[model samples]
Target: MSALDPSVAGQLAEDLPPDVFRTIIATFEEDLTRLVQELQTAHESGDQNGYERAAHSLAGASAAVGAVGLEREARIAMDHRQPEAAATVLPRLVAEAKGALEALHALIH
Candidate 1:
């Protein structure tokens, strides 16, 4: 599957003004970076609650932006009850986020 759902993104772009859409995309990028960092730190620190919280936040944000792959990965991360389990999925989650961001950026530019 694609990192982003183009139809959903296209709809969003069509519904919002150019500047507003750009702002949302920019905010998503910034939030994605911060959430991914939080996920990493939580994993490294063995903070399962923090890891799950970050994953949940990421999933929600990704969904809003039509970042399907990232949202899927984030949901998977959220499902993990243990830090070690979440750690296994961290790389995939990060990769998906990167791909999603790229796709989202393409929509605005």
Candidate 2:
């Protein structure tokens, strides 16, 4: 498994201007934060469909930015279609995503 960080610069720097790459990273961060919120809300409300949506979104977004840990956790959560299973995975997914976000912030700054 790859280590997680905001590695967008390495992936996109060759093709994009530094400013634009930074913008992409910033956008990713914003979107991820929002998705995490959605996951939290869905988990709290026992909304299986909402949880799955948020988890799937998180998995895709994190994968795009090379957030391996977050992506892995999110994928696991996403695979849990049942409410009980999703609820069981939510804490770990949230924890891993938060850790990945911290790593991303450190890299961005």
Candidate 3:
């Protein structure tokens, strides 16, 4: 996990167990929370790149976990150069990410 890119989900999942994935989901959930917080900061600071990076990460992770809703939200987020434009999409991403995590947990355990 150390040598490989943490951004790729397949490699991220290679060593982690189902329970660990759930734990990972928990961590991601926190990350998402922090992401939104950072979005607020970025928007206030007019940091377009910050917003984009976070959205891009969200898109990749959502796609990896089969979270179509989150992926959609993330795409919407990444599409806009302005965080205000992507603001509404964040909740959907959170919901979808949660759903995808739940589904994976069910299938795994």
Among these predictions, the greatest lDDT belongs to: 1
Rank candidates, lDDT, best first: 1, 2, 3
C-alpha lDDT of candidate 3 relative to the true structure: 0.64
lDDT of 1 at 80: 65
Q: How many backbone clashes does candidate 2 have?
A: 0
Q: Give the per-residue lDDT of model 1 (tens digit) for 13-44.
A: 88999899999998998998899999999889
The worst-scoring run of ten residues by lDDT in candidate 2 lies at 1-10
TM-score of each: 0.91, 0.75, 0.61
> Which of the numbered candidates is closest to the native, going by highest TM-score?
1
In the range 7-107, model 3's lDDT, one tens digit per residue, is 44445566678778778767766766777677667766888889777778777766665556667777777776545555566666566666665554454
Model 1 residue 58 CA deviation in Å: 0.2
Candidate 1 regions exceeding 4 Å error are 81-84
Model 2 residue 27 distance off true place after TM-score fit, in angstroms: 0.7
For all predictions, the C-alpha RMSD in Å is 1.9, 3.1, 6.9
lDDT of 1 at 40: 93
TM-score (C-alpha, index-matched) for candidate 1: 0.91
Error of 3 at 60 (Å): 1.6
Writing each residue's lDDT as its tens digit, candidate 2 over 1-109 gives: 4347436524554566667767877888788789988988988898878988988998888888778888878887787644546556767777776776666555543
User: What RMSD does model 1 have?
Assistant: 1.9
- lDDT of candidate 3 at residue 11, scale 0 to 100: 50
